[model samples]
Target: MAMSSTCAQLCLRCRGFLGSKTSTRLHYIQSHHWRIWTANSKSLSNGLFTNGSFTSTQTRQRLKQHMCYYNNLTVKYLTTEAKENKNADDTVRSTDGANLPQMPNTTALSIPENMNSLDLDAFNEPSALEEISDEEAVTIPFPTIPPSSTSLRDYVGKSETLTNLVQLGVDLWKLEQRPNVGSMLLRLDFSTDVAPRLLFLKNIGVEDSRLGYIISHNPFILTEELENLQTRVNYLVSKKFSTETVASMVSKAPYLLNFDVKRLDNRLGFYQHQLKLSASNTRNIIARLPRLLCGSLEPVKENLKVYEIELGFKLNEIQHMVIAVPKMLTAKKQKLTRIFDFLHNTMKVPHHLITKFPQVFNTNLLRLKERHLFLEYLGKAQYDPTLPNFISLDRLVSLPDETFCTEMALATLEDLYLFQKTL
Candidate 1:
């Protein structure tokens, strides 16, 4: 048999009348034989449409109508099947694939039998997407601005966690929030446990070389680490680095200088006193050092020291100081000697003043003399590689009006100097 005849026989035997009809339509659509199918029915020669015996136009019209009806019916049936499957899927709800309690309509208030016993009666119904009312909204608590570093513990305090974190230099902001890291931080054993996380955060500020340098090197950000930040700051100061170099590094940090004036003064006084006196006296002051270290002191103390030295009045003796209120340091005699020795030798005080003030000195000085001396000391500090390279006086000439303060600049430089020398 020919290919067409054999195909027709197989369709009739396997699929009855419907199979033959579908096969013919498939064959016509696939073969681009639309014109042949719609041709004359009388063209069906010898009862076989493939032969010249079939040629009637009426027969072609009937066959065309049958193919169109069959196609439409098949599409309708498939669409209905899909809809049924979707409806079945919508019935599943819980993790177990069990049916959920669903509303009959948008307006019906009848609660589902399953969820009726639960505490989610208010949320049982689907919530509207639009803002229903302020009363119905969920309130997301805003994160509290972390208390300034002054209120926090020192990285090396009783907190093992904080010490480890400070050593590693981790960024606190980048840390992934554990199940409830913030809450845990707030309520943790602050005297012991909290320091680690905070110190870790401080380290993170240090590690952000681009921005972290600003924070890490910043007196404000590193207030907590001031007592312990000897190596890094000393290295920078020893290189004869300028204040601008240090300032530029700190300008990029994310924190502000939030050290408390009164608190920091007390702490610095306690430390400075111990430094001037014998080592035996140091033990008495060491007990309270942690309290001051963990508080805001670095920035305020740094700025204040510059003002005190520049003014030529003992900071502890000044009548009305910004951060200090006179009579703060009890061992003023010893403290003044130590500061004088430090300024004269390591700082390279002028030859004229060296011979004049030789061993003992008084805070009272002629006007502008102390300021002049301070500027000169700052200059030497920047150029001297033997000490920590802090700030270059040259850079001060270029600072903006808003960011630069001659007094504060001097103070900062002085702070850097003292910090570099003695930590």
Candidate 2:
């Protein structure tokens, strides 16, 4: 009876020691049970408790039941906490919005047959962001959308500015009939802004229909200031570009009117002073190479250097060559080198003589090669260095196909045709 009383007292003390909180209760129970078991294990094993109301087996069984109950409680509490944490994580992911980076598609992560055998480390280098600076991080700008009208009629109804512009010379009916008119009108702004500029262009000899064509081709010209357009025209006139030539150039390359006067002056200077071309020749060059009016003269300058330094031509020789065939100045360096190599090293033509007949360089490389080789095969390639027939380079290259076959090659057309086919 005393032993039973003592066991009951111990059970009450153990229960009291464990707190009511579910989280800490399991921990306390585990620790306390271990201590109690370890301290009393030897006595229990020796059968000292045999005479007690509770046998050692019964005591161990009771302790085991308590431990199992606490363990089950702990598991249930942990499962409830895990469920709450998972809910929080899901809420965070959904609320992140655009801040969260996009994940790659699961399909994209599937390994290809060849890649499956390769070591993953080879492709798993650190992200470029780590190496780059904060300033270097690319800023993705929000797209900008220009204000748009639903339709021409709707646009005219809403903006009085656009209605007035249509009244002035912009053929709104024609513009409305065309596709993408909303975008075109938006770019042109209110017609009131463009009318004065159109009048300015008309005043400067751009005919009514011609002005329409210019506007159609390059509507942005309608936004240019009258004074700026007049300045470009005046600068062209000062360079001796005839009004007709200026009008033609402007009509064909309307962007020419947009260039700054200083830039126009610099290009004119390059043509007259550096290139040694007369005003008339400059106009002709511009007609042929329209881009010359706005593009950098650096390319022409570079070609001149190539002719002077690499090909060993004097300045006068280069000036004459450019005046004769301005397109030669724009030819690729490799092309010029190939022609020079053929004429100088292969044909044994002197550099001075080649410069004298720059037209020789304008001939097709294959034609030049075939004709020269055919002449050589016929044993008529060699000639006196001083005579007119003395390798008449221009005549050799510039002759038409029929003339070359009958006169120069001294062969019938059929024979030349057959020879070319074989080549």
Candidate 3:
């Protein structure tokens, strides 16, 4: 304990007041062979205290209180420089000039990975951090020097922050959407930025499982102002969405709050007005497909033309179909056209019938054709209610093969299966 404490005091006094951790590290790295640093987490504050940079006990105490996160942080300093004296005694002189076992010299040196402000030319000479004695050897009781390793924890200084993020199911790499993640983690104050955001997310009712997806995809959430975020959430609630519903929207579309509220309001208005939908219908559409706000309006507008002009659906029918299945608006242009052609041309379905069962088009083309062919073979492909044994377009596409055959087709599952196989 005494030797380690002595080493800590010596390192703090010799190296601590050199500005940021980056400059301090560069100074040591250039003379890495001579400087064996302390691993104490609290060494920086201690260094400032000893060097008279922080003179007042109250000022020092406040600094300590603010930067106390360094407490209990064990930092490993690794340096490698090829040894010149292989036959030299395995010893270094301690701060008190005691003989200590020398740290092994090697071929490569590593700057602390999280040090963000490195000036490689910070130290042109080794006198800044003087070696007390080069000829004598000393040893101090210190934690076993860890074997060489690179870890997420090395870059992310505080283990608890990482633990909480991992616990929340966040992928550390996903947080790299922001540049310089290692530096950010080292400098990020958890109390001010990270914790409050996490708590705010929870208080807003984002689910635990969804937390990972939301945060990993949108790391800016950690840095966004709490008041601004609250305003966005409030704006959503003001639009008649419940707090719980807003959480669902935010989780699914993590960037939803990233949009301006006026733009958001304009978007909501666009969807409602463009579709000629009721305000309630527009809200329902957003509830069902939160990503609706994120996509470009061009494709949506184009498809509206496609439905009314090319597909020959009346404007009113288009609105009704979109309300029934809002995703229909976002459906692939070619596939939607193909499905509409098949329903209107091949199956002789009326425009109103297609509107009545908009979800029928949601099924793939092959399934629709295969089932229709199978029904045709069985002589049961009737759609008119007045005709005998009518088959709804929905039941045709929706039911499992066996259920479709037994209930709708009045044929065996084997028949349907065999027909499908032939196709």
Candidate 4:
């Protein structure tokens, strides 16, 4: 190989790594190749002598009296060719290291004195991927996300049964109602407990993508008996709900199938007879709000009573309110009562107007109160849209807070905030 002139110089700098630059050089004498240096300072003179390139006569005299320290302290090396000219007594080689000619533009490296010869040669790490094993990618143990990311993911790494479910995209966060589902999942056999339900749902026309979210939202659907689930579907069909409507209802509220067949029959009967909802209207309401059947029938009955007896709404107005917002049928009786009392006595909103725009039930009572009070504060509390300075009830709650403050309230958000704080 050829040699480069800029070699073996940088190792002499011996500063930090930043101060060091990459260099191509290697230098070695026969035996001093990896030798350690020691001082021969058994005897010492009283003082040390120095000079500034010996420009003055005193510097030359002092240099002449003492040793040539600069030349003595500097290391001197013989090149490969020069070693042949040197006496054999000055050159030596150890049998342990390989004998190689001193080459230029190469780095000199030696194993440390304490390191074993085979240790350096044998230290190799396996090159396999650490995040996931190939076998896990294919089978009942998928790579898991952190527990903090979603509730059941941590269990996936440890529970073989859960790994496949997570792989299928079941979002465990929606299972907030089942706090111990992670441990409970370990006991279920996915092939028997879950796979049949998945097939049944798909056969019933539930979309494939919604399977995971529906199962997570209502975990009981998976554990529910296949026979029972099919019976509920059949009952809906018996009631003239289409196959598409049944599947749509399941997707919207998975717990709809979890209800007992008799209880479901009673719910369907209540809508038909007691509430006097027409067959088409009942179907429309169920198709829109499927979870209306999830809870017991008592709350629905009580809210209907509150709308009629407690709030003094007529039969047609109640039916119109139900048709306008199906959710009001299942809303808490107390909440319905509070909204009615405030709108009736305080805001003086007419009962028929409340029935026509029953979506006002969706707004928070506190917000309704604050807006009404703020409008009164500004002396613009007129609600009847035909009257002067009328504010639309729809815009009051439907508009965003900032938009409502600017357009309807005619006040800044700061004023509303201060007014709410006082309330």
What are the runs in model 1 whose C-alpha is more than 4 Å off?
1-180, 183-275, 278-289, 295-297, 300-307, 315-423
Candidate 1, number of clashes = 45
What lDDT tens digits, residue by residue, belong to model 2 across residues 272-390? 78777777877788766655767666777788788989988888888778777878877777778789989989988887788778988777899889888877876667534676545
Of candidate 2, the 10-residue stretch with the lowest lDDT total is 111-120
RMSD (Cα, Å) for all candidates, in order, is 22.1, 19.8, 21.3, 15.0
Q: Which stretches of candidate 4 lie over 4 Å from their true place?
A: 1-155, 171-184, 411-415, 418-423
> What is the clash count for each candidate, in the order shown?
45, 2, 5, 2
Poorest lDDT segment (10 consecutive residues) of candidate 1? 319-328
Ordered by TM-score, highest first, the candidates read 3, 4, 2, 1
Candidate lDDT scores, in order, read 0.39, 0.66, 0.71, 0.67
For each candidate, give its TM-score against the true structure: 0.19, 0.50, 0.61, 0.58
Cα lDDT of model 4 by residue, 1-423, tens digit: 000111233244312121222111122221122222112222223322232232345544543422222112211221221334232323533533545444332123222343222221222343465476688767755445443434565566676557777777787655534666655666678888988898999999999888888877777677789999999899999989999999999999978888888988877777877668888998888789888777767888888888888899899998888888989888877788898889889999998778768889988998888888988988888888678888878777788878888887778989888988887
Q: Which of the two candidates, 2 or 4, achieves a greater lDDT against the reference?
A: 4
Identify the candidate with maximal TM-score.
3
lDDT of 4: 0.67
Candidate 2 ranges beyond 4 A from true positions: 1-186, 189-219, 276-290, 382-385, 388-391
